[model samples]
Target: MKKVLILALLLISTVSFAQTISGKAYYQSKTTVDTDQFGGGEMSEEMKKQIMERMKSFLEKTYILTFSGSESIYKEQEKLEAGSGFGGMGAMMGSFSAGAQYKNLKTNQILEEREFFGKKFLINDTITNLEWEVGKESKQIGQYLAIKATAVKKIDPNDFEMARPRGRRGERGRNRDAEEDSEKVADTTQTESEDPFDQIEIPKQVIVTAWFTPQIPVANGPGEYAGLPGLILELNVERTTILCSKITLNTKETESIEAPNKGEEVTRAEYNKIIKEKMEEMREQFRGRGGRGGGRGRFGGF
Candidate 1:
């Protein structure tokens, strides 16, 4: 009877521990932009400085990740305003910002809430697990002893984050004298003139360096990062680096881990297609209004 009682108590304790396991991690995310890559035509150094100042808020942001053992929700913390003098440029940059992202390790599902130019979309997709190679390297992140891991993360070829401004616009007006002589020439001219994304080469993959702590014992991290042995404390992806600033585990107050259900449901491919189309339209509008400014806006410019 004593042995049976001990086994029952152990089972009960395990259940209790699993039920109450939840955590909140605060991360400060920052991305560096090279202003030198954004010089439009005759833009002066002072103009570049002013542009960097305007982009400061977008380059740096705070995010909160609330997670349970199997699920997590990551979103940017609310702020009163992005920054002072954030005009049209802010709105343009904000279009690339992602909304709340929900991840379910148990279900192998990833859902993201994205808004592009006032159109809300719920991207429902299966999580593509990355094969992380754990290393012997270790470091201290706050009070946690984190282990280093690296992975090669595939990115979209048209990823705006990695885009750089072109030195000049693509040459257009092919077969100009012929005018309506051939439909092929008109189509080629439009393609060369309107699609600015063709100018810059965006990398297809980037090296991801992550530091995770087994002390947390949760396969979760900020943004679309996971599949680690523990919660990720620091992540370095190209120009962006996200570091966990604070972590609260097993608190009396547990935030709900509900997946975001709002917005029009769309697959990841559909969403990317929509964004590409809208981006082209926005680029044309910018060009029509500001001429060479649109070329600068392709990557980090206004």
Candidate 2:
């Protein structure tokens, strides 16, 4: 009877632990944009500074991550409206993907609804288990004490819009099948302008240093990071850093957290394949203006 009682108590505790905890973490992120890299064009210096300022404001924004121990939803906070963008950039006609990401920690599943050039794409994939080396260093992020952790992550070069050349205004998603292009072997003699991804010699890798607090014992984080002992309040991915400003934890877990079932369903790998092809097409448009080695860009993406 003693053993039976002990087993029942253990099971009850486990079930209670699995229950979702309602929590919201606010994060402020900032990234540097090198406008000089895109300069040496016909635009005046004053115009360049104006464009850079706009880009910086766009890059530095606040995000709220509402999560429990098991699932989370990451989205940006709404801000004031701005006048016309520089070259109508980030408009409805623009081509880019910035979407809400929902993840299930226990099942190792993620569903991100991305908007690319007037189309919606659902990226469904299993999270890659990252191996982090926990460190003894500790620092205070706001009120909670945080411990340091580090990891090296491999990044696909094609994932960065800065790495690829963007096409003209109003250009959007290409419906061309990547498999059709993949079936034909790439020409060795000709440059891989149409397939610029092939031109990337090495895959980019970044050192990720994250800080989490054990005060909240949950494997919850922002973006594509998790599996830590506590909530990740601060994350430094390469040159970019996202730091949590505030956190509100409530037991009112009434909201339902579910994976997004909309958009054209595609695995992460397949979606990347489409991006590679589209990037190739964009690169070709650049080559048509002048060869790759020739001139500077008028404007660039971050």
Candidate 3:
């Protein structure tokens, strides 16, 4: 009986030690798009190059994941800004992008802060348990020995980040006034026109490949990814690849791990619906501008 009690005490101590461990991991994320499909094959190679160069600022990014054994916060790294003519557009896009995400493995919960235009939304949802198929492949990423794992995840159709330019604009466009209230945003009928933003397409599903190291012993990673046996050092989903560039473990100074409290609270489903309605509104606005000779059809005035 005493031996069994001692064993139980050791297990408890191990768990406590694991929970006390904390660190920050920095990742570089990059996404690529096919320039040939930008404008129905009408754009010159030079034009495509220029567009890609302009998009490089938005496509390539750096993120930081501050994590413990059971909790984590992932957010994009802030950088010094240079003067630009598109500052307003940049600010709008920044809000549209995913905000800080907090995950708690013990509670199986995720809290995400999102901003649409000028409104803020706090998404409170459960963490999706991805069933990863671990493979025999092993590789060295930085100083960590990582193993291969893959999973198939359903793509969120409303995700603008995953959009890829198709061949041409669609024949129909939806025109609606953008609503400030989430409840007022509804799926409604549309009018017909040549909508340039319709050229972008998002797939239904994607295969995700991840590399994780057991040395970290944490079931957390950057973005909305988790449920692994270790910290994910690399992730590849669709056209984006996130690679961890550096890791600082068990620092002398630790950050407080807590969920964001700002913004109107909503479920994941509610947030998706809200974003969809707003995107439809923007599409119509661009379509109208294009019809009036003020719109650059390729990438909505890029």
The clash numbers for all candidates, in the given order, read 0, 0, 0
- Give a tens-digit lDDT track for model 3, residues 166-212: 43222222231222122122111111333434345667777889998
Task: Give lDDT per model, in order.
Answer: 0.70, 0.64, 0.69
In model 1, the Cα lDDT at residue 167 comes to 30
Query: Which prediction has the highest lDDT against the true structure?
Result: 1
Better of 2 and 3 by lDDT: 3
Off by over 4 Å in 1: 1-20, 40-46, 79-91, 158-201, 251-255, 284-302
Q: Which rank order by TM-score, best down to worst?
A: 3, 1, 2
Q: Tens-digit lDDT track for model 1 on 1-302?
A: 66446434543444345345798999999887555444222458888788777777777889999987577999999643343454344545555657899998778899999866556889999886886777789999999999998989887755564554333122234454453354344345434454444335456677899999877767778998987767899999867899999998884656678899989999887887776666677766756655334433343322
Specify the highest-TM-score model's number: 3
Which lDDT value does model 1 have at 6?
48
Give the per-residue Cα lDDT of candidate 1 at 241.
95
Native-to-model Cα distance after best TM-score fit, residue 26 in candidate 2, in Å: 1.0
Q: What TM-score, over all chains together, does every model reach?
A: 0.73, 0.70, 0.76
- The collision pairs in model 1 are none
Off by over 4 Å in 3: 1-17, 79-95, 167-194, 251-254, 286-290, 293-302
What tens digits encode model 2's per-residue C-alpha lDDT throughout 87-168? 3233312356557889887788988887664568899998766767777799998999998988888776656433422221
